[model samples]
Target chain A: MYKIFLTFILSILLLPYSSTFAVEVDMLIPPSDFQAFDTPNDDGKSVTLRWPSSPSESTEAEYVVYASLRKNGPFTTEVLRINSKTMYEEGSDSNFHYVEIKPGKFFNKDSDVTGGRSSYFFRLVMMSNSENVTVNEIASATPKGNWFNWKKLNNFIILIAFSTLVLWFIEHAKKNPNLYLRKISGLDAIDDALGRATEMGKPVLYVHGLNGMGSISTIAAVNILGRIAIRVAEYDTTLKVSNIDPIVLSVSQEVVKESYLEAGRPDAYVEDNVFMAASEQFPYVAAVSGIMIREKTAANFFMGYFYAESLILAETGASTGAIQIAATDSYTQLPFFITTCDYTLIGEELYAASAYLSREPLLLGSLRAQDIAKGIIITALVVGAALATIGIGFISFIFKAS
Target chain B: MNFFKRTIPLIIAFIMGIMMAFQYYVPHEASQSLLKVVTRWGITIAGFAVFIGAYSLFHLHWNKIKRKVPGWGYSTFVFFGAGITIIFGLYNGGEFFLHDKQEGTMFDWMYFNVQVPAGATMFSILAFFMASAAYRTFRARTSEATILLIAAVIVMLGRVPVGALIWEFLPPIADWIMSVPNMAAKRGILIGVSIGAIATSLRIIFGIERAYLGGGD
Candidate 1:
């Protein structure tokens, strides 16, 4: 009796820490038709989906559907809350449950299918009462694919036009062999910011964004960091390159150290200057914000991908009156940076800045090619608009004519 | 030597880039196998790089602790956190439930419960700061500022129940502002941004941008 009492007390104490018993329930929606609608509405392929409603469906809760591109994917994750259209009748035995699968945007003009032409694994899960749990999943579903992306006609034309412009520019560059100059305000400010730091006898801080080395934007940031490090080495001024991503941090350390070595200032390279502040996002932001305030960093160089923290960093820099030079490929935060920073590189301009500053032949040539692509795109747009106004099928004619 | 240094990575990049590009259009089993091999090698190389990062981290913090730096105590905390997690992870070798699950381990506990919450706390604090900053910085200083301030106010008001009660037209106004004017501006910006990205990619692919390859004289 004493042993039993002790066991009961121990179990009660462990109850909160112990994992909750997961209730498994299977939820099904009715059979739906997957149709192809290129020429017209036609029967094509089929897909079946089964989801488990919440462990308790009759209770006050709803479910959302998620589909992944593959068996294990960067899942087709949507944050939209969708309620269960069909619920099990507690007292009735019904095998056939009618489900109204809403027409997704991927479908062209009231087509009864979702977008993309890949096998997707779908799961139905509930999100309510501070608990999110997956209820049921269909192992596979293939959305019908139509070859012609009619909806993306605008994008297709733009691509073709841009490719043409880029090719044209490449050819023009090859023939002329002349240096093409493009304005980059951020590149111009690099020297000014560095000079300010040099005069003030204060350090410059460089953040290589919040992405891993695998990201293209991080590569751009690292490239820019190398340039700044070289300048720092030459000036014999301090340059602290803080990184959030571990892999990028390693690469950045190498890049900065190499830059210093090349600048004939191998002794000036401090290991602590190139530090990795955690892999997490906002923590890195806090660390950076703290560093900016603590160091009284005269210049803040922000280059790469940034999200909500972009403005926070920029605003803090503004507060400090640092010559903030920010370049990012992110469109969302570009406006904020522009409003706050002294020099802001918009989108591809970040990439262009590196090329303009470095002027490597490959970079120049590619820039030239890309320009040609853009010109071609503009020409196509002009031609397409004109043809539409005149009621002629100019784009189709061009495709067929080619 | 110059030829080798410049052309080698460029050649490799081009070949890899082109191969990957073509593989997307091709539907061959051999191509698929090649892609799989490339992906596997990429992942392996990435894993090795991660190992290098871990080593660097160890070296940096170990030196700090040895030198008795101000934050040396934190270094000890990190070492213990990392060591205990690794020790427990390898000891049970998946036999124990605690060791079996990745999240069940101590590292995950520190990561999810402690580190993640600390990070989230920092992130959520931004919401309050944004409101304050918006009010201060977005005062009608100019035409653009006035327009921005008005739009922001409308959007903020439209998102709440009180705004709908005060003005029924506010919701539709907010929707129109977001979907039409905002969307148009966003689309324009997106297109412009994509153009820039493509240009940059072409430069890297062709080997014009060697600054990323680590700049030297």
Candidate 2:
């Protein structure tokens, strides 16, 4: 009886120890429908993975994502905790879990692995209660370098449509160059300013703002300068062009010389008159200001991209009692120009001045196309505002740029 | 001569223009690498173009001095400044280009003392100019001018501490004007400018606008 009682007690103690070693439940249910694909619109540097959340996942469960260059083994792993309500809500709809893995970061390499050449494999494992379950299949994807990004498809479409419209108008204008463009007050004042300078027998000073040839504003300024140079040649008045960029200085010299030649006054074109004062900002402004004061210029034309120097140059011209005409696309400097200069071209007016002065079919067509585009944009803005007021938000997404 | 001067340049411009425009849409590494190379080449070309500007400056000043122009003395000062700066920069205080300028070097001393002070002095002069410009322009002669003057006053007052002491709502009203009307005008200008720039670029690429090529065909 004593031996029997002892054996029974020993067996009860061993029962609890055996339960600890034994598997509690079948926790090897793999995630379903695993997939990997190249992340779009990238430089072949990343791949995204997706899988249906395992039904076995609970509050205590953790996910471990693995990535490998080869299809099997030697995988680099990253632990992910999806314990919060936000995580569950994010992937709740399709019971989907997604992650983007950069192969370079995965392999701890300095160079990128997904250069559109290498294939990568990924797997997801779910761990709960010390038991783990991994996906049955190793998902693989080869990131490809796309020839074109589809995400910017909307941008491309808009660009193509506008470009085609402009080109069509250009062709039409080439046949008929009598397109109606509204009168811009700032541009109309150009003649008056030039005439004043001619009457005063003082040179007209044109300061090309501090920008290089790459800026459209600078190109517009130069184009306007050509028109002004022709008029100056006809009036037999001197024109001094002060430039801050070397390339623009060279180009302006050529343009002014050509204008003089076209006006049958090639002898009047002085190369020294169109010159670069300085490359640096304040120094250039100082040099130009000094010229404005010393020459006692009767009229000053400030055109192109102006920065902090706008007010300084304009104020000096104002002090000189010159007729100042300023034009720039820079909004910050617009207030300064308006307050100091006599006539100011507000934004697109600067661009329109070129077409207005040149009256070329190509430029006229471009200006007309821009007006149409602006009208469309304004209509869209009004429509978008109305839609939003009515609690329809989808129109905003349609008009979103990039 | 015509082919080399006109036709070849036009062809090159067309090819380059199209390539640059389309390259933005491509997400390929090779295309991006090519863009980098082209950008570097452009910078290199710009570096060489600086010499053209320097020569133009020298020629202008030399002519002025030769003719004994009214400001010929100023031209002499310009030469002196430029010569000294260039000499010191190239000398590098007996060090090579790869090494940094020594602490007591003439280049370092002149850059800190002469160039910096002159630049700062020029910048500081803008404050007085701005005040004078404001005084001349803030006169309320017309209705639009009156409104602009009021807005300017409110903005100036609201930015300082004295504004809050006078009127509590001044700051918020000023903020509203800047955020609403000012912002609206700014956005309108931005959109208009972007479209205009695009149109200009298209005209250039199509070779329909030859003003950049010296106006007349």
Candidate 3:
């Protein structure tokens, strides 16, 4: 009986020591396959470190990543807790990857690393039960500037292909000089609108939209204005252009003046007719609305980028019983313009209108090229979809946009 | 004279356009810094353009008042509003232009109370206009018109809680139309617009489209 009691006491004394041994064993199992590489497609300021989780990884195990300029000693450590649910997984294997940007500042704020490029060494330590074990081999990476980013090589390829097609078509059209373009109804109605205004003896109002000179739609609007101004000059009718941007107003004045000169009616051109109304949104709409009411404009042209003011301007013009023709690239406001305006140029039609009206070889050729590009895109999309459906997704990957 | 007038401008534009386009592909720090510098220059130029616009406005209203044009009284109000706004903006209620506009300042007060309300009023008026336009255009006179009308009704009803109460399937059908047909059309337009925009940009960069340069010359 005394021997049995002594044995039980001895076992209890060794119990704590056995638990400590198990924890030490767990901590000794370090992470494996540690590697580091410079991150691509960025200014040479970041390096990525990756390592497989410790073979004895458990729910309680956490990772601490350390970095050092020199391969030996004085490492700054960053504790990283891996959430089991959110950590990335590849098949049955999971790896811990961390991107260290400007590693000197990131690992240690006091470390001065502003001089030039320097190599960085990384070590990952796995910790559990208040015990830690670091990987044996240190991984190193040096961030260097790359002249070209291979990741965006696909984007460059598409751009080059599209640009080549456009240029080739332009050159071809220049040689041929005979290309057919479909008639757009919105553009066709411009003459009729201007004619109606001339016959009615009422002034025609042309609004170059609320957008400034930077917008593509606004540029298109100005182009169309040039053509319309020439037509107005020919018809000997009054043309009033209301502008919201001062720069656009000045440009419009020059365009209109030039058009008048082209039509040999420079004397008939009124400088003040092409005037800046207001710059603010609602205020500009209000001014244009007042003009429509007061002038009783026979024909109204709303072209370029419009916002909430689209409906306001269109409604006011509609109330005047004017023949309203609108064109915009703004899809959100298309419904409003279609509802209010007599003729509305939808999307690409607005862009094509200037070319269609001018019949300039350059513009026409570019337009044709765009149509071809669209065709190619459609074909690729259909083929890619079919291939993807049949489990051949490599074609889709080839056409993937950045 | 012609060289200075046209050639120089076109050459400048070409160089700038090429540089700007190529800058996008470069990920170097120097390239990014250059882009920032160019953007700052653009902003400065835009500031000058704003001043020119303000001058144009002043000239326009001055002419209106000078001629006693039919609505000369309204022109006076425009000048008054502009003058008051300019004074408040420049003064910034004692902080001047050195510090940002603060709360309780005259500029902030006018902006929040007068400008905000007026802008909101103008925007709200669109609801009535939209209803009127819808009434005229949504008539079921043709097959296409009937389809449009039905779609419109479905979309309008689906947005409200009463729609779900009336028909359990309304919301899902509305979501389907919006997600499928509406999205497809919008994407089509976007693609077309993007292609067109690229074409236009190329045309401008190559100096092929010069109507923007002014018509005759």
Candidate 2 structure quality by residue, lDDT tens digits, A1-402 = 999999999999899866644433444366777788998887777787777766555566677767777676666655244541123325368487766667655554533355537777777777767777777778888876778988788778878989998998988898988999888888888889989999999999999989898889998888788888888898989999998888899889989988898788999989999988998998898899999999999999999999999999999999999999999999999999999989999888877787788888878998989989999889989999999999998878766765
Residue A257 of model 3 has an lDDT of: 90
Residues A1-402 of candidate 1: C-alpha lDDT, one tens digit per residue: 999999999999988655343332233222232211222111223343433233244344555656554456444564235454354334444322223332233233333324534444555556555556554334454544333435444555655566556556655656666666777777898999999999999999998777776677887788788788888999989998877766787778878887888789999999878887655688678868877886789999999999888888887877888999999888888877887789998777776777667654444555766565556656766798788789977575553311
Best by DockQ: 2
Q: Could you list the iRMS of every candidate? A: 4.7, 1.3, 1.6
B111, model 3: CA deviation in Å? 0.8
Q: lDDT tens string, model 2, B1-217?
A: 6587567867887888889899989988888988999889878878888998998898999999999999899999889999988888878888855688666789889988987898899999989998888887778888988899899999988889999889998999899999999999999999999898888778778876666666365
- Each prediction's DockQ? 0.24, 0.67, 0.65
Q: After superposition, how far is residue A373 of candidate 1 from its true place, in Å?
A: 3.9
In candidate 1, how many Å is residue A56 off?
A: 37
What TM value does the first chain of each candidate achieve?
0.58, 0.78, 0.81
By TM-score, rank the candidates, best first: 3, 2, 1
Q: How would you encode candidate 3's per-residue C-alpha lDDT over B1-217 as one tens digit per residue?
A: 6577457867887888778777777777777788999989878878887877777777878998999999989999888998999899989889898888767889889989999999899989988998998998899899988999999899878889988999989898899889999998898898898888878777777877767665633
CAPRI class assigned to model 1: acceptable
Model 1: per-residue Cα lDDT at residue B31: 64
- Would you list the C-alpha lDDT of every candidate in the order shown? 0.68, 0.83, 0.82
